[model samples]
Target: MAEEPRDYEALMALYQAEKRRREAAEQNALEEKRGREAAEQKLRPTNLPEFLDACHIHLHASLIVQKNPTMSTQGNPDNAKNKLRPERLERWEDFAKHQMAIWDDIMASDFASKRQFAPLSALEQSGKDLRQQKIGSEIDLHIFQRDTVDKRVSSIIESMYYNKELREKFNLLGTVNFENHANMLSPESQLEEGMEQLTVHQKGKQAKEKQPSGSTDTAGSSHPRADQFCHRTAAFIVEYKAPHKLQLTHINNGLDEIELEDIVQDVVQRKVDDKDDVRRLVAAVITQAFSYMVNLGVEHGCVCTGEAYIFLRVGEDPRTVYYYLSVPEGDVTDTTGWTAGLEGPNRLHLTAVGQMPARPSTPSCGQAEKRHQSSDEESGPDPDTPSRQQSLSQPLSRTQKTTRGSSSGRGHHGERYHQIDRPTFLALMRRQLADDLDTDCDPVGRPGAIGVLFRVRLRSHGYVVAAKGTPAWFIQRLRWEASIYERLRPIQGIYVPVHLGNIDLETRYHYEGICELVHMMFLSFGGNLIGQHLTAENKTLVSEQVKRSADAIHGLRVLHKDLMPRNILWNEETKHVMVIDFERAEVEPISAKRTWKTPTGNSVKQGQTGPSACTKEIRRAMTELNALTIVIRL
Candidate 1:
């Protein structure tokens, strides 16, 4: 053995050969995995929910890595979005983990918000079902539902492998994609010739994979395949509710005109069609995504036109906005940055390089979503169980039994949503106002930041009626109003405006979760008191009302910070006077002294040294102001 030490060269060669053989084995195993995945993909479910559900049961569940807990809403109102530094982004995996955090929040926010609409009875009933042995336990219910969806998914996948099942269940057509199939917003774009032809992989109803070179590049696995590491894009939005990516619904392509910025402008200014809409929109969006997305291969957003959308879900805390054609791509490059030969939307792509698709809304011609008019797509009333809430749906279309590549003859599973009954409520208001406004050019009313007040015929009927929104900035005012009325409610004889019901819109602004835009109707004291001429009798009535109201609010431990001529309503005919608009109302500590700047620009004080420093003196001051306004008007 000692004499054989001279044979080191021969041993080195042998070692090299064994290394090559092991490498070959890894390559073969990788190829086998690719083949098995391809075969499975051919039998994939029709949409994201079904496919992901199946992926779960198949033990190949896609991972959703977590990121920061509270993204958009966290930190200072100052410096909210971390600036886009093409340097900070290191991995598609990190960006994805962050997005999952945000997307999870958005979806959860949506589901939880909507779940508020679900009846307690239904939730109670679900518990009862468990207690009654209808379901073995809470886990059993989950398992049952998962199993139902998984069974369907398994069959859809299996149908592709078994000719008898495939031939019997599906039409000899093509697979579906979510972009078009889940598209509930609008119509389909016209297809060009040769777009319908069957490629080698799509010869059957399922799609083809790994076609080299032309329109698609080594089309790894249509997004969200088992072996596919990156969720790639489309976290199930225009939206995503499921964990799968069967449909391009998971990824919304910025292929059409986007009105998202308009919504942003509206959110910022609280007005529709403002001149500063674009400037404000650009400022907000750029500020939000620039810091983070720049490093992720995005230079800036579509500043010329807002061609962007935010991806949010339940589990994640931060929501991310993606630029057009910018999505994470393959492993051609190392995990440290963008793939080889990858630039950005406009270059500077240091790390997370994304693909900006030069296409329209959908993924494929066969699986593309058919667009329709949102207002017109109505599901006719269901008479058997006509619950007003359940009768409404906006995005979900009526179910049609066509061959949608389901394993059974049934169509894709249709989801129903609740409709905000604005039309019915508005019509009733219009009629109520019509009977009240005498001859004031119908349907037109004076609009304000919080609400639109209509001079209704009801003023002559003794009270004023107004329909208005509690704006985000003015929410504190609304809460104050509610509290004041609730306090004044128990005090006798002061006119507290009678509140009618409010219709809640399911949609929310892009701010914090608490600030919702809701329309409330209140029976006020007078109609447009700002323009009203307070007669002698009206002065007497208003003086008495203000005096009592001021004194009442004090005993209730409150301060009506905003006091003006307009706030004290006057109905000359009925000599009815009432105070309104308690949004700026405050309930201060008994020992604390505070000065408030009222709407009239007067520095009124409870803590300051005014003639009326507290409530009892405040009423006397209101009486004097009422007298002066009445004299000035006359």
Candidate 2:
């Protein structure tokens, strides 16, 4: 057959086909290599962030960062749909590859030689701000004792980044009851024998007409009956160690055997009986929680019912409302019991039921009157039906509006969370704490996160730990911050000491139980350049430093998100400024092309008015860091 002369067209076609095959193979290989090595650079700079910048890593915690891949986890409100999608799987793979690169680099390099922890001056007893006056007004001065941090992050804890074989280290913490743990007090929804995602429920939405109990078992009910699938699962929350709360202040503290649900039952009964005082207090508490949830990217799963009790520590505008999912065995009341929940098609009904302000005309039975009204339209309003009030609470039209919030999923780029050993994390933190310096933000606190500031260790140059309570809402923010810093910790001195590592230990003296969320982070020391007067040399240095840090931040394709004075740390002693505070940081596209633009008077003057002039390619538009203007033009 080869004896026949091949045509020129046939030979050309064969060559082109071979060329395409080779190109495809090359592309696949290139992608595989990129997945193997860091596509750009490894995370955690080589001996990154010198002394002053290192100290703030504890104070601001997320101040330090290096170039690392972004992380995001897949989640759906419904538990059944919580598994990772194909895109999420790719992200997860990339995250693993990124972490492995760090480990490999750490192992292959002389990391030990780079462990010079001397950064900021040792913590002093007075705990006074070196530069007087508050920075953010977010810091709680009451908790600013010189020695408070020493009491935290005791000697026994191990680093999570260094410890490889964690076999016997947790012996002191007792048989770490991994399974026996509490999570937002949601009762166990353990499957009985065999439960599938598609449970053969035997009822429909209109099945409540025949029975008073609303318990009629209809064959193959359209409504989803799998408890696991129905429990409003926020899978992402548990991706990085399900955030757990040990204790919260109980509402009916005076009553010896009073559970949170009991207090709710009392409050609901009183409101039903036209108790104006109780109704006002209860409504205020619930409304506040709803507003808070809305701000944090949540829309449902809180209702005013006896089974789901809300314990409140109410006094100020920022009140603490604790959500307890289920009551004790005997605490279930007639108004709310085991089966009393928002279920079936029109969900969030229970919360809507008792939410309206009592009408003076029918104050005693306003809820009852509303329930009848709701049922008449819907045919069979199950006892667990969402009332008119609950529907009003999460206004259908409002939730439909797309919003970007702490709890809301960033669909295309879901926030990535890292899962590493506790000890391995502690090792990295132990190093940062070895170079601790105190940091303070707003004297009171940020809007969502609570009274928090990383207190420097007393006199000892040891690992600095952020000893502050963070709200559950802060978890996503903290995780986001941690991801940023973890990926970029290798970048040389880009941010202040941001997030160091996770800390979990057994404290002997003060907190008896093994501390849960003692996540350790190094905050660097340079104070913001607000109060300090600057010379010409210093002014030039500050501007250059600010621009440099901003450019570095932009290089990671992550926005400082907040490029302002409060977050800009200036160390007079070190003669340089470092960027801090990444709680609100967000990611965007990075570009290599640059377009030169003439600096206009408007662009320069906007510096005072805080006007941002957007450019097409790079979104770096804010007119900020004018030392001339910031010097307070006396």
Q: Highest TM-score: which candidate?
A: 2
Backbone N/Cα/C clashes per model: 44, 69
Per-residue lDDT of 394-414 in model 2, one digit per residue for the tens?
Answer: 222111011111112222322
Per-residue CA lDDT of model 1 for 420-532, tens digit only, reads 23343335545544343234311121122243333232222222233344434444444445556555655412333433334332332211111233334433222224224
Give candidate 2's whole-model lDDT. Answer: 0.29
Error of 1 at 629 (Å): 4.2
At residue 543, candidate 1 shows an lDDT of: 62
> Measured by TM-score, how close is model 2 to the native structure?
0.28
Q: For candidate 1, what is the lDDT?
A: 0.32
Query: Which run of 10 residues does model 2 get worst, by summed lDDT?
Result: 235-244
